[model samples]
Target: MIRLVIIGSGNVAQHLIQAFQKSLVQVVARHPETLHSLPISCPVVTSMNEIADAEVYVLAVSDHAIAALGHEIPGTGKLVVHTSGATGMHVLPKHHRSGVLYPLQTFTKGKPLDYSTIPFCLEADKKEDYLLLEQLARTVSSAIFSIDEQQRLALHLAAVFVCNFTNHLYQLGADLCAEHGVSFEVLKPLILETAAKVQTLTPTQAQTGPALRGDTATLERHQSMLTQPYPKEIYQLLTQSIIDHVQKL
Candidate 1:
């Protein structure tokens, strides 16, 4: 069994911890503070000093914390890896072998994920290190990709636009529908179809609307119905982007 010590116990840590445990990897220790209020069932430590030896130490902390603790973690020729999407593998402690094991998906505590379907973007300096990381990731995910630093950054940004920004748009749609005494569920089919089309079409190509058709009248009326803070500029900007896409087509 590969002895795995996960540094942080947040959502990403929790998910990874459970996954590692289920895969029969020995979870050596986790940071107590990272566990926070979550009732996580694992051996935890408040500091790195108390930790026993492990084959791998996973730094699942925030981007900022990775660099700080990168130097603090003791070296055992153990694989030191971070779960950061944008941060390079070299950001970890220099004495220990370093790598990345970023799972390109949003996570929430207790929300189950099918790891086998999730893409694990991996990177490492040495061939053996890369192979080791790849094998560990493959223990759960079948969709592991040997992505370099730059591509991982791009994938991360794309996720932000698709997941975070799209959810914000959904929230706005629900609020607007509520104000008009319309059921938000009415938008469910449209939302589902939009997501479905993306699996078939590039987001840019799948784009459709009054903006793409240059249907100014509908755009104006829709803009009129929207109130305060986010309507005018966002509508004009996104619509112009869609118009640009259509023109390119």
Candidate 2:
């Protein structure tokens, strides 16, 4: 049985704690409150000093907290890894074997996720440690990737554009709907269909809108109808970008 110690108290840490609980892995966390929402059966402590020695210590803390936490954890040659996508492995303490076990999926506290669909991006300085990470990742997920720091950084950037930015657009759409006294629920089906279409169709192939068709009159009307300056500017910018992109194709 691989004994695992996870540090920090956030969405990623909590989600990881929950996932490992169902596996044969022994999980221990430095911060217990993070697991408050989770019905975890393992040990959870309040301090790093109270943490038990384990085969792997996963630093699931924030990007800024990583280097500081790495300094605090006693390595003793045990495998210590972080669950960061942007931060590189060099930020980890060199006294011990350092690695990365970044789960390439958005995590929400108290929200259940299908672990099998989430990819685990693994990286380690040593070959043995890499294999160990692979074994640990396999416990909860089948989608595993051996992505290095450079590749992970690129992937992280792409995720920001696809996930975070797109979600922001959804929020904007919701707000627009609310302003027009239309229930956001009305857009749910369209949103689902748009997302489902990407499963088999390329984003470019699935594209449909006034901008894609180069309907200048509709685009101008949309820009003019936007009561707010920011939204109107955004609409013009995005519409022009789409038109420019389509022209290249």
Candidate 3:
């Protein structure tokens, strides 16, 4: 088993600790209080100076802090990786064997997830380090892919569109429903069906809306109903995008 030292005590860190409990040797966090809920068996340290000897050091902190944290780690021989999608592996200290082990899924604290289904995007400075990262990733996930920095950035951008943007749209829908004295629960089934359809069918093939169909009357009616400026602008922009996509198809 690859002995691991995970840094940070946030959502990603906590999830990783649970997933790799067998291999975890130590957890390093700036605030010891943040790690109170962590496993008692695993040694927890407040600083990098006290970090245990391990084959891999996983920095599960925010993107802005990755480089600074990487610099604090004592050794250059061990593999040091971050769990960021937007940030590149180049951000880590030059002395260390740097890499990225970004999980392609949104993490919420206390929310349970099946790690097996989460795709792990791996990148490393060396081939040996890449293999080591892959081996470590397989302990939690079966879906692993060796993606370079550029590819990972592109994937992350697409993820923002598909996941983050889609969720914001759902919030907008819920707000509209609440305004009309309707329960957002009524849209749950539709949301589930739409998500399920994309599993087997292309998004363009599964697309069904006034924008896709070029139903001018319905589109105009919907546009007029949106009293808020921001939501109205978003609606128009997305509707036009859909229409343009269909025209190209």
Candidate 4:
């Protein structure tokens, strides 16, 4: 049995805890600020000092604490992995076998994750630890990739642009619509379709609109329609990028 200890009770932790429970693995849930709450019955430890006898220790905490807590784990061989996409695997102390187990999808507390769909981006120092982590990951996710620390960091950077920046743009779109007396709900279909497209279509290949086609009249009309600087700026930048992307083809 791969005894697992999860070191945080946040959104990612909740998703992982449930996923592991569904697989019938022994798991310990703990949190720094809040009590671990899951209706599915498991040992919840409130402090780090209480942790004992774990084959795999998952540090699901924020990026800041990984180093310090990694220093405190008094062993040389525990498979200590963090659930951070940005932080490097070596952030853990060299005394222990370290790795990263970043789940590439956003997680929310109490919401069920179809673990089978979520990609596990895993990396480890030792071959044995790497294989163990991969096996454990495959139990929860069908897609498991053996990524290096460098590749994981690059993917994390790309995620910022794809997920984070795209969401920010959506916010800008919502605000632009609201100022024009348009309902935010009206953008919902476009949003859903945009997400669905990238699953099959390379985002650049799926690109559409006046900008990609260089319909200057419609582009001018879009700019003119935006009465405010914010939306106008976004329109200008993205349209220019689209034009560039289309020109490359």
Candidate 5:
């Protein structure tokens, strides 16, 4: 069994704790309320002093907290890893063997994740340690990758563009729909279809609409319909981007 201790109680931490609850896993949180927030039934404690011996220590705290909170872990030569996409693995305390085990997925509080489908990006200081981390990752996920710190940083940036930025655009779409007295639900099908198309076709290949066709009349019509400055700016920017992209193609 892969014995491990998870530090932190945020969305990522709670999800990890839940995913490995059936395995040999323990949890340590700095705040008792954070631990209580989850319906976890593991060996949970709120003090670093109460941390038990484990083969691995997974830090699932925020990016800024990883470096500072890492000091709290006892550096007993145990393998340590953080669950961050953007932070470097070197941020962990030097006393312990450190690595990165970033799950390249957006996490939501109190939501269950499909562990089998989630991709786990792992990195370790030693080749043998990499295998160990892989073994633990395999228990929860099938899609495991050996990603170095630099490559992981690049992937994190891409994730922000595709996930975070795209989600913000989704919010903008909903707001626009609301302004027109249309239910956001009416756009759900188009949104899902757009997402589904990318699975089978490259985004460039799946591209359509007035922007792709360089229909200036339709583009102007869209811009004129948007009375809000932000939406108007975004529409013009994206429409121009699409046209520019197609021109390159």
Candidate 6:
């Protein structure tokens, strides 16, 4: 079995520990107490010096801390990988074999995830290292892709628009519902249907709303109903965007 020494105790690290429990030899964290919540059997070390010999060192820390943390690892020969979407593989210690093992999904601590469905984006400095990364990735997830640094960064940008922005819109909708004395539950079916539609239809094809239909009167009334400047501004911007997209189509 290919042993892994995961460094960090954050959301990505915890999830990875669960997924690779069988191969996980040890977990290195600055605060060992942060890992107490996890239900893993692997030994947890507070220092990098205590990290056991392993085939791969998985740095599941923040993007900013990756380079500094990479320097602390004991050896230069071991394969070191980080779970950052925005960071490039070159940020890791130049002496060690560097790679990226970014998972293309939003991670919330304590939330259950099916590892098989989560896409694992892999990159490495050497072909053999990439193959080894792929071998490790396949152990947990079947949805693996060999993406380069630029492509990975682009994908991360797209993910923010689709996931983060969409969730914010949902929160805005919930707030609007609460303000008007309506149950947000009423919109649940519509939300689920809209999501389901995009599975088979392209986003453009799935598009529907007063803005998409060019219903100026309805759009005006909706805009007038929004008292808050922020929501109103967002609505106007999105309405104009939808109109522009339709005009381009």
lDDT of each: 0.79, 0.84, 0.91, 0.79, 0.86, 0.93
Stretches of candidate 5 off by over 4 Å are: 37-39
Question: How many angstroms is residue 126 displaced in model 4 relative to the true structure, after the best TM-score fit?
Answer: 1.5
Judged by whole-model lDDT over C-alpha atoms, candidate 6 comes out at 0.93
Q: Please, what are the lDDT tens digits per residue for candidate 5 over residues 1-249?
A: 888888987878878887777654678887658667666666778888888888998998889999887788875678889999888878888888888999999888777779888999999998989999999989988999999988999999999988999898999999988888999999899989989999899999899999888788988898889898888998988888888898888
lDDT of 1 by residue, 1-249 (tens): 566777776678778876776333333334455445554455667676766577777888889889877677775577889999979876787788989999998897667888778888999879898998888887888988999999989999999998999898898889888888999999999999999998989877787778877788999898887776675677778888877767777
Q: Residues 157-231, candidate 6, lDDT per residue (tens digit)?
A: 999998999989999999999999999999999889988999899999999999999999999999999999989
Q: For model 4, what is the C-alpha lDDT against the true structure?
A: 0.79
Give per-residue CA lDDT, model 3, range 139-204, as digits (tens): 989999999989999999999999999999999999999999999999999989989999999998
Q: Can you write out model 2's per-residue Cα lDDT over 1-249, one digit (the tens) per residue?
A: 578887876888888877776542434455565567777776667766666778888998999989888777764787889999999999998888899999999887677899877899999999999999999889888999999999999999999988898888888899899999999999889989998999899999999999998888988888777998777888888888898999999
Give the Å shift of residue 169 in candidate 4. Answer: 2.0
Tens digits of lDDT, candidate 4, 1-249: 467777777777777777776433334344434433565455666666777667888887779988987776666777789989889886898877898889998776666667899989999888889898888887888999988878988998998998899999899888878888999999999999999998999987688888877799999988888887877898899898887877777
The better candidate by lDDT, 3 or 6, is 6
Q: State candidate 2's TM-score.
A: 0.93
Per-residue lDDT of 119 in model 2: 95
Off by over 4 Å in 4: 22-37
Decoy 1 TM-score against native:
0.88
- With candidate 5 superimposed using the best TM-score fit, by how many Å does residue 204's alpha carbon deviate from the native? 1.0
Q: Which residue pairs come into collision in candidate 4?
A: none
Query: Count of backbone clashes for each model?
Result: 0, 0, 0, 0, 0, 0
